[model samples]
Target: MSKYLISIIGPTAIGKTALSIKLAQHFNTEIISADSRQFFKEMQIGTAAPTQAELAQAKHHFIHHKSVQDQYNVGAFERDALLCLDELFKNHNIVIMVGGSGLYVDAVTKGLDDFPDVDESIRKTLNQDLETKGLEHLQKQLEMLDPKSYGTIAIDNPHRVIRALEICIGTGKPYSSYLNKKNTNRPFKTITIGLHAERAIIYDRINQRVDMMVEEGLIDEVKALLPYQHLNALNTVGYKELFNYFSGAWTLDFAISEIKKNSRRFAKRQLTWFKKQEEAIWFDYLTPVDAIIKKVHSTINAEN
Candidate 1:
């Protein structure tokens, strides 16, 4: 029999973990989590990492493996996850990897773009502009410099947009121009299965999950990590919304509302991102999960 890697991905709070656990138990194999936030042990509640029961069900790797104080990015994640897979593959041919984080998934399966380095002064200039003139000013600059990126980037998210503009201005090359490169080859075969549902259903689930997170002490989680709020890892959706509240930029109600709104928007973008991959096989989250699992089983059997 041939072995392979099964990657399950979907929007936040769309039941990716439950499905992954089921598959891991079925294959009797370990799971490698690609959740970027869950890697930080300090971010347990906010990241919705696996519970104790799920952890005990199957051996897992990469969950709660880092700290918010550490500077871990996709480059580091790619190195670590591939290394874990290398050792796991020695005994078992099939390993399950699952997460909603698009960049990490792409990094492991397709590899990251060879982004050119920018001078420190370039980022410093942009940071100064952000503080003095605000992100709107830098956003307008990015739109003018790289319209393609401007169309795809989250305008409200200043850091990413500015990063793109910084590269464009510093390297004299459009950010999108570099993205046209090809994917790097991987040693293992990747079978990507995406979970999806109707927009209303997915959005409602996300909102409900946010409300549950609040009831489950999400505010306290953010409070505990406030000292590390400036870290890139803490810049995620759940934490950032509450950070604005802490900074007095918004009221508690407003912050909660923004969390739901941003989370919905993020899920939409996730769907859009995953939809672009022609190889991804999607299944509705509500329908009989066994059907999809059987399909996966058949597909794997055929490939084997």
Candidate 2:
């Protein structure tokens, strides 16, 4: 029998966790999480990690499995996830991978794009610029160096901006040139299932999720993680907004509003990213679980 990996991808709060759990139960296999933010052990309510009951329904890997202090990146996650999948495919013919982080999902299904080794000095210079000149300066620099990336990638993310600038500066070429390369061959076949909804519905879901997180102690979660706010792992949407509030930069109401707005924007970006996936099979977010299961099983049976 040919092994297969079913990837459940969608924007935040679009019922990915619920759907992934249901799918995992149906497949009688475990799940691998590609959601980068949920990997940190400290972030729960803000990252909207699976509830204890949901986790009990399915065995999951890479969720709350790392400390914020650890130097984790997509490269490290790729290596670790592949090893986990190797062990999983040993027993199960079908494994489920789910998350909103498109890059991490791509790393496992396809592979990381190749970029020439950049000079360390370039990164150091960029870091210095970020510290002294501020993020806007670097953002503008990326805009000038790689407008395509500025338009596509999360340019508001300092790490992404610095990465693009480093590559652009090191190779003297636009950073976007290194993206969307040929995927590496994999031992198992992958079936990508994308869940989507109307724009207004998605935004409403995002807003409701943000409110849910807040009521579930998202502020306290951020308060507890305040000491580690400087860490890259904490530089995320919900936590960052709360952190700003904690710092007196914004009121609690404003921070909560910002979280909702940023989450909506993030969802939009996710949709844009997933839309480029030519091989993806999409369904409305409200699609019946039985129907999706039938579709997946039929696809698997046909492939086998």
Candidate 3:
């Protein structure tokens, strides 16, 4: 009678979507996506969001559920995801959650760290700094103020950098100081499944995926969203690089190359974060889906 949350986590382009759909089908359950980039309805191609066909194979929640203009954050996602899980547990004993966004996953599984409410003016000033001084300036400020967060966070993303800097400035403490302080209790048991691969293979896969995205109209997608490129949701790996190209700051080839390089770096950071989950069960990226499902069943049985 116990409910279970089967969480699938890994780096980008590692086939988490495919595996998650299979697992959901096997368990006869629904899926919750934790990828923050894919939440924006306009970022389908660049984010490599689940294709309509893949979505049709399994019921999924939280994909393309919000607009890029929406000011959504991990805190809001935590509240929303927990509510979704509460409703899903009433119908099925098991539900699957999948994505590569480490922070979002931790928010649902562990709980978010509590911080004092910062003044809106602090955030406004940070945004002003970002506009006038550029992201590199803010990033350097964070590196000086909170080196730990600078190393771990998506430093290339302006939104993440600004968020950290705002906390440091607003509270007069290192942003990293607020992490890992809260332990939330949930109703259901959680079983985390991590997918991994060799560094060379992971990099190659990311490069190929980025190339495919370009071939699949990633540039066009970015062009369509040019009007809203200033939004936080648009400040992501695939979109930001192309924005530079559109601005004539870089050649198209260079922009595509940056996307791959940045994506590879993002994957490295993702692996570093997910590997810290000492309780997670990890599998090779190419491992048989049946083997993973069997492991999940055994874990559930053992827990019961």
Best by TM-score: 2
- On lDDT, the leading prediction is 3
Worst 10 residues of 1 by lDDT: 150-159
lDDT (Cα atoms) of all candidates against the true structure? 0.85, 0.91, 0.92
lDDT per residue (tens digit) for residues 1-304 in model 2:
8889999998888999999999999889999999999999899999999989999999999999999999999999999999999999999999999999988999999989999998899999999999999989998998898887776676657898899999999999999899888579999999999999999999998899899998899999999998998999888899889889999999999999999998888888788888888999999999999999999989988977
Per-residue error (Å), model 1, residue 239: 1.3
Better of 1 and 3 by TM-score: 3
Q: CA lDDT of 233 in candidate 1?
A: 79
Order by lDDT, highest first: 3, 2, 1
Candidate 1 vs candidate 2, TM-score winner:
2
Number of clashing pairs per prediction, in order: 0, 0, 0
- Model 1 spans with C-alpha error above 4 angstroms: 147-159
Ranking by TM-score: 2, 3, 1
Task: Write one digit per residue (lDDT tens) for candidate 3, span 88-130.
Answer: 9999999999999999999999999898888889889988998
Model 1 — TM-score against the truth?
0.92
